[model samples]
Target: MSVDEFCRFCHKNLKIKGVFSQSTKIFEKTSNAKTVFDRLIDLGLTLKRSPEKSIRTCRRCTSILSRIERDLPVFRKWEEEEKQSDSSEQASAPKAADQSNWDPPASKMPRRVLHKFWPNPPAPNQTRISMSARRSITEVMTHYPSSKTVCNVCHPDDAGIVNNISKKNWKTAAGLMMRHKDLVEEIKVKILELVQHECKTLCNPSQGFILWRSSPEDLKSFSFSSLESDLNRLSPFLLSIFSTATNHSLPSTCAAAAIAVRGREPRMSAFSYYLNSILLHGGARKAVFKKLSKMAITTTHCHAVGKLKEFPHTCGEGLQLLEVQKEVLPTSGADGLTDSAGQDDEGIDLGGAIGTHRQRDSQLKHDLVDSSGSQAGQMCQEKRQKRRQEQSTQEEEGAEWVSRKRLRSEVQPSPLRLVVDCSFDSLMMFKDVRKLHKQIQRCYAENRRTLHPVQFYLTSLGGQLKQNMDETDKGWVNWKDITIKTEHYHEVIPREELVYLTSDSPNVLTELDDTKAYVIGGLVDHNHHKGISFERAKELGIQHAQLPLESFVKMNSRKVLAVNHVFEIILAYMEMGDWQEAFFTVLSQRNGAVPVDQNGQAVEDKEDDDSDRESDGTNTVKDNTSSMPDQQEGANEQIEAK
Candidate 1:
């Protein structure tokens, strides 16, 4: 049992020279494998240990030492079992394998019992590391989960749970915020505080210095409950950062701001939400528009001034040249005064300068060459006029070109524009869902206790849809709406599993139809209905004109797909609706029928509870549609200052 044989045979000829050197502390100072193994043996252990003689003969001492240290628990267990089995023989057994059988009898009962209680170990040749230890390493390295129950030690709270869910378990992470309200609020507060402090510090000499100084790792390590919570707080700061940078281009500045603010939050959605928030706030929106207007004016002036500089130098030099032409015209005297004047039709008139008769007649006889020069001068004037006309046309064209390709203008549409990528049918459904979410949030904010189950579903679905739309580059995809004429107790299914459902009829409206209704908005905020499937989910879907499944497996999958899509659309619609309200208030001085508060500004509020809308409204039950005739009058006139 010498260390040399174990190192040479078992260690695959591995070397341990630097940190594992013979004189290094692992081998010399801290006690070697032989010490640990011998200690266990001295405690009446059955496991064999390399004595000092055996240790001294070892070739690769560090490897043998490490192996023995790692296996100490196993050896300790075997020793205990042996002692408990036969108290007398445990003292006499010198060879390590003598007391404990390394290859115990393979009985069916024992194997069955082991199988029932424990997972099978990794094959001997396949793994040198313990499976549990490997899993720990994996959890440490990854930002996501890998199994049903992640190591709770690695994830103490919902933040850890969310971090692992995307990679290891999407189901757990997707709805994490709904489940962990307290944690979500705590995270939201921290982020808001950070953002507010960062924004206010812009007045300092070292403005934006904190963002530049803080490492991304440190920022991400800050607790985050959900992506949306992070966006609500962090977005304003990110947009402000770009807006404040004087010389930075908008696109580059926005990108840098996005990176700087990206931590535990999903960076892409955060970017979109942040930009949207800027558009929502009146001051930020005004600042952006002002900059754009100034830019356009400055560019136009520069170009126009440049073209003006190209105008010909004409006043003094032209008069002198014309004087010479007048003298020459009379010298070619074969024609009368009238004929010569007609022949010199293109010549400039010297009549206005001929105040005195002497000066006029002094246009004395001149040579043929001067007469020809006068004609040539006339040609030059004609050419210059034509060039000016062409230049004017080109200038107009150039202005048009610049207008089309301006820097900020290119990126402007990306932020301010709302694109609906889903099918007509789905979009209509989304609209209903969005309205529901808004109503729910208004209720929640107002401290209303109860919400109809249908209303809750609609609100919660809206939030989910919004999240999905924000997650993708293209935003949302259109699907035909499920329209049913008759109601039935149809089985409900998830949206995804219904991918193969019947296509729209030839008469059905496609997404391309201009008149198609869009899923304008929604919110997935109902917290109490977690995990409860809606009644007749599958049957309801089918009755609502969803296609039948091929088998039970397909039916369940289709149900799930349908549900997921519905939820995703719900999320997208709700947030978009929130932004829509915010944007309307900023741009139009009216957000549907939402009333202004005492501060003379539209209440820039979130619809957290259903009652919030009614309480906040100066005229309770004010219309919430932008389409009503005289909508502006309703918002401005309906609410008197109180």
Candidate 2:
């Protein structure tokens, strides 16, 4: 009998079915597996197998081991190269001199070092300087050259100052200092001020260079009243860079300064990258355009910027233009027709007054004018027909326009209630909150466009998420078939009717029930808070379920869908009455979702592997054992007995 054990590498506990036995034959089939086995042996991991106790590994640990095995050789080579370079540098470097035996030259020595070597002799009637003042003076002198010439700040007279204060020059030093007593005192104060400034600069370097090395606080303190003058001082090229980086909305000098300092580097913000995308889409040359793109900034890869323009904002403007065109075109056509009729009447009057040959020529000219008019009319009719054909084609392709009044009156809302629990606001960061708000807006927009919009409920809506929604989507309060509340879902609806939809749920939902209120967690944590929604549902004692994603389709990545994506999928299914079609229509190609057969295999892969099924006898035998009814019944009997 085989017993379940923890994985040898990751130490993850695996059940009997999940355990993968470690065998030399299996290792030989994978690339670099032998090397990984040897490395594990070197690290004191036991791989010896026995009849009673066999070595086992989990699937995740096996995959990770394979990846490490493939990359280990490159890492080893890099380490060896680094060691060789370090050894070479050490071999060619000069040795340091013995500090006890060597000394710097007297002329180039620091004043602080000179003071350490020699001491001023004590004398009667000599005023003693403070230790702090002496230290300040020593600091100032360290930067200047050691010379006998008098410093103008210290000594204004043409007398030489004492550089070497020996016994012979002790009287000379005292006399020189006494002669410029007031000047020396004044210079000492100035030296202290200089040292203080240097210390301040060392403490906070941003203050010393306000323009180039400014901190966020310093930038924020800039006066907006002088913004115009400050902007004038900046070159047009720099201003243009800032303008493009901020999407042409330079709010204040602080924002401008932030861009000047931080925007030079790549991957500064999402707004910058969005601007870069806009420039690229607008036909800007890639080589010349250097703002927030990876080619220039090199921090992030390509990302999808969802909904580049707001639908309602742009759609309203387009409808207004259409209305204006409708009003102007008819009036212009009527005026042109009246002008043509008046010209025809004048031509008739001229024909009566002409001679026989002139009248004949005039009649020919009139006939030519009538033919031209008919030709113009035919061209106009053809254009109108073409326009009508385009409109009909658009309608056939499902681009038919729906008026707001008709949409509100005709389409009936779906019976199924969809609740978005926004109580997870505390779990997400500021940026995640904003992203959640955007997704909620997209959900609302999608529901409005769909024929059968669900009864939408936004519960526990407050905090930063509420503020963002209020600022961007003011009309959400007046939306039909929607309910906004500040209470939890449990308080709003009965626990029996609530069904939390989370990816971590064990129960799979094949189809939605009209009696049940489905709850989607209105949180965007980028997968950080895994199993949170499921745990919450369990704590609340409500039923929890996940979409039947794995049963219907094989995904190349994780089966986590966005909030709007889940909402849209529900709406799609409600309209189409098929899960496969709904998933296919809502999920983009990037998701890599492929429909699977009843055997739990990808359709394409299954088709390709049909010919090799007989050759792969071991896999076929294992599948048979798993699918055997007798074995399944025996396993169930053991479970019931336990």
Which one wins on TM-score? 2
- TM-score between candidate 1 and the true structure: 0.16
lDDT at position 262, candidate 2: 39
> Candidate 2 — what's its lDDT?
0.57
Per-residue lDDT value at 75 in model 2: 61
Q: Taking the tens digit of each residue's C-alpha lDDT, what string does model 1 give over 128-244?
A: 331112123223342455444434334333444646564787676646654465767877797789776654443232433223322222222222222223333445554555556
lDDT (10s digit) by residue, model 2, range 1-642: 243364433334455466444522212335643543465554334355544332555665556556655666676677678779977996899766666866553332234423332234236677643211222121113234555444233221313343424336777766666556566787778766754554333234333333332222222233333333344344334445556776776454435643443345332332233333334344443244433343333112212111111212232222111112111100111111111111111112111223464555555445434444656667877898987888788899999744433446667777899999999988888878888888888888888888888899999989998888787778778877689899999999999999999888989999789999999998777667878888989999999999888988786655777788889889989989988889889875445667888889989678657756656665542243353465334333220000
How much lDDT does each candidate structure score? 0.33, 0.57
**TM-score against truth, every candidate:** 0.16, 0.36
In model 1, how large is the Cα lDDT of residue 478?
33
Question: Stretches of candidate 1 above 4 Å error?
Answer: 1-202, 205-463, 466-642
